[model samples]
Target: MHFKVSNNGTAAVLEPYISMGGHAALLKNDRSVFVHLHPIGTISMASQEKFQENYTQGVLDREDICFFGFADDSTGNYFNSNTSPNGEVNFPAIKLTTPGNYSIWVQVKSAGEVITQKFDFNVIL
Candidate 1:
């Protein structure tokens, strides 16, 4: 699902993984940035309240569920964050000490019981 905050600094953009990643410059010159992570693409999540009753009576694999982050600069000096209490979804944050560009990413894995997938809304300041 996509997120809209009326007139907030955060903006969403669909960046598809290209054959070569293409020529992109994830940079900005601002401060007090915000990143709203929404569910992008996922491995698929159905109903799984009952583990044994579900698939082969075993837990799912969710260790691959990891998020990736990158700064706008080559120096790599950006902060990172994760989801909230339940951990279903999240909005990772990065406080910019220097007004420059930064890149953020997230990967929610499909576990045996619970899992989630979110997007990255960049507010580069």
Candidate 2:
């Protein structure tokens, strides 16, 4: 699989040759700064399904389902603004907070097998 990345100061935009299954990025110096990105968005599909299930079953109050501390937005649509239809994954710009080394791990599924590729980059302030 091949990937092309474009760093826009605060975030990195990735265009993969093929559709991606899952992907993540981490600050090499500070592990606390990590983000998992998907083709859909920040919220995982499993989480969305679970939230839907709970909402459908009336197990949780509609007003109580908060996403990333935002209430009344259980669908996670607010955080999914970077979704693309061209097999591109756009990570949040906040992930590149400080100038240092970073690693982005991209995963793709092919023929029922999962393959992971790690790409390294440096952020200079």
Candidate 3:
């Protein structure tokens, strides 16, 4: 897989040359921080699925009502589209609060199998 990284102000923009999939993650080396990323955004698939189920069952109103546990006001509009374009997965900026080493594990699915790539870098204060 080919990946290109560029800086967009404070965020590191990632352009991975592979079909976008779910279950990508970034982690601080000391295990102080971890973020799960999706092709759309940080919102999890299970959460989105639950929101859809609730909305369909009439258990929740479609406007301005937030459910508990990771549900936000934009939950209804979430998962409406994929943020990444063709042949590239765009991740939000990488923000490390402290100066340290970090590793990013990006997973993509191809031919019904999962491929994982590891990238390591350091953050200098």
- Candidate 1, 14-110: lDDT as tens digits: 2212211111222333534434332322222343334325435545532233322221211111112222112223223335555445444333322
Best by TM-score: 3
Q: By TM-score, is 1 or 2 better? A: 2
How badly does each model clash, as a count of residue pairs? Answer: 9, 0, 0
Cα misplacement distance, residue 57 of candidate 2 (Å): 8.2
Give per-model CA RMSD. 16.2, 9.5, 8.9
What TM-score, over all chains together, does every model reach?
0.21, 0.46, 0.54
Q: Which is the leading candidate under lDDT? A: 3
Model 1 misplaced regions, further than 4 Å: 1-87, 111-125
Candidates ranked by lDDT? 3, 2, 1
Give the lowest summed-lDDT range of ten residues in model 2.
Answer: 81-90
TM-score of 2: 0.46
lDDT string, candidate 3, 6-98, tens digits = 234332322222323334678898899888765445666699789779989998765553211122323443234322222334355556778
| lDDT agreement with native, every candidate | 0.28, 0.49, 0.53
